[model samples]
Target: MRRLRNDLPYTFRPARPKDWFRPPALWLNRHWLLERKYRVTAIEEQGFERVRELDATGDSMLLAPNHADHADPHLMMEIGRRYELPFHFMAAREVFEVSKRASWALQSMGVFSVDRDGPDVSAIKMALSILAAGKPLVLYPEGEIYHHHERLDPLHEGVASIGMKACGRVSEGRQVWLVPVGMRFLHDPSVEATFRDRLTRLEDRIGWTPKPKMDLDERILRLGQGVLGLKESEFQVNVAAGGIQDRLESLCGQLLEMVEARMGSDGAAGTAPERVRAMRYRIRRRLLDVDHPPGEDERTLLLDDLDRVFAALQAHSYIGDYLLAEPTLDRRAETIMKLEEDLLGFPLYPSARTARILAGEPISISEMLQRGELPRKGGASALTSLLEERLSRLIEVPAGAACSTELVSRQSGETG
Candidate 1:
């Protein structure tokens, strides 16, 4: 019932079988070939009968799936092409804003943008009309790609809203297929680490040095080349599992457990930025989920988290190197304290909607502890002694530097 007005004219077209041999169509098809060569095993098309039926009978439908990877759209495109159907995808503007070249390529491949932050009633109405008019729509129920598979957040009510609105009025015979796609990549998906250097090359190609203030998402994507690892095979074979989020969650759990084992090993404790990056490669594999939330088109929350986690890991690497080279133990401890304070003060969750925004600068820990960082214990005496034991050997620390024997006094003071 909602209308797109003049903003998006061809957005919601009536049922017409797409012949993809035309200009943008052919180019779009060619664009995904590299993906096919590197990442697809077999692009399977299910419900040929349904596709053919929709084409012949003008039934509008939406293809919905859990968002897992950046390549989710391409996977659908490859499958849609094999079936000879064109399904327009709904994505956030952020995905396309990398540049005109990238945005145009996505649009040409039958992908379109919906304003994620600002409300676009017209675009929503336009999308509804497309489904009502007997065309196909592709949407990622999770709304974003995660580096690793994790539990699905609750499904969004939007897809259902569109379906209910179009029932028979826009759709016929109540025939809509909720095609569940379970794509498993047979490669290491370091997504961030695998692609960091390549992304630097990309920046060089563009002849632009990124401002430190560039959008976090843009910086993450630029380095997202290694976000997923290289293909284990020239042809990626994906086996479709059952379509529910829980089933996918169970499968993801198994994969994550394996990832965790490799990440927490002693071998990865201290190293350079590259070594730390490799450590993150394994850690992210465990911490992040591969399965996307249901009914969302692409959630950036996880990617944002990945960026922070990786950045922290990188900082740790640098600090580790610094500590190893520092001449004195007191200075090293001060540096460590400084880093901790910086992170603690950064917005852990700045926005109301986003639960992980950094809030402010971190407190200096000596100040932090003095300000009662710990609830009950006044800095454990034995623990402090043990730490200072090794640290004393490294530097000419003052005689009373490790003295926390006044814990009894400190605790009483804190209580008051």
Candidate 2:
């Protein structure tokens, strides 16, 4: 049998209430498990000192960060160590359910579960408890890793809702702060070659042969169009062409329409990410629990439906790369990484890449309440958009940075 590398080990602890924030074990995990083992090159701090100031004031806080990659949680831990702040993190229950030992370790480290697919009241209460205690809680609003560092996925409204609700729970004198954090992954320039090689390998594996002298943009367009084209064919979609973004959007809309039609559901409104979330919520209602466990044939049919749902979600999550109009070398490299991850199911980038942890100015719950933003109808949606806007600005790669657009241009088809 082939051997697979295992994750870091942890000792088990009985589930109970404890001082989860101030654990000496977390620092050890950050040093040995995250930085040393995972090779996190450096965390470029931006506006982190502001968080330090907030900590000194003893304000209750929740961090809503953009989820770009798998390493974000660990990177945030390292950030916490540097700032001398301990935080409680909200994690998906399935992570704790991976193994008993893993569950115990994470739970010991001030991590609590929030069921993403369903209403978990206990999890909600736990989050409120932490906030009411005046401790900082890190809640990722994006909900899952979308693998685009510069893009902010549509946020889940739960973050804003919880923050406002927790604010109300706090004493009149105390404040609950919602801090927006942007985790941007930056890699070495040499990785451009790596990206190209990887893309070439993927193209070969998928049996795609680009026309001679194709520019980088054209090649990328062709590759993306090809993938989308296949999915369209599978769904019996009439081919629509108007560059990558237009066609991809149309295809996803059609797919979602088909999904909603099958489920006897309507209201496929909002952006792709929003539609996907709504669709998944409906899907969960059907699949979450069955009184009787399904037979083999029943399980296969159920699995097929799930596969389609997830595929649609992924298509929605990933199409944001089209937003990059000025594709620099860094942007192009990251795009290739996206392709590698999406196509070959590979890591987005090497582990040794530097992560820029950008913390925007914390939004004051008191101020928001006074401004009539909190507790208002559609307030959560508005606040989420505001947070997302802050994150988008924070992750913006400087246009003046030394990146070779020529490299990308050279790789494109002649028409590009």
lDDT of each: 0.39, 0.67
- Measured on C-alpha atoms, candidate 1 has an lDDT of 0.39
Error of 1 at 60 (Å): 1.6
- Which candidate gets the maximum lDDT versus the true structure? 2
The runs of at least 3 residues in candidate 2 whose Cα sits more than 4 Å from the true structure, single-residue gaps closed, are 1-39, 208-217, 266-269, 292-299, 320-324, 371-377, 397-416
**TM-score per candidate:** 0.40, 0.81
Per-residue lDDT tens digits of candidate 2, residues 221-244? 677767777777776766677766
| Winner by TM-score | 2
- Candidate 2, residue 126: the lDDT equals 85
RMSD of each: 27.6, 8.6
The collision pairs in model 2 are 214-412, 214-413, 215-411, 215-412, 215-413, 216-411, 216-412
Give candidate 2's whole-model lDDT. Answer: 0.67
lDDT of 2 at 310: 59
| Candidate 2: residue 397 Cα off by (Å) | 6.5
lDDT of 2 at 147: 67
Number of colliding residue pairs in model 1: 41
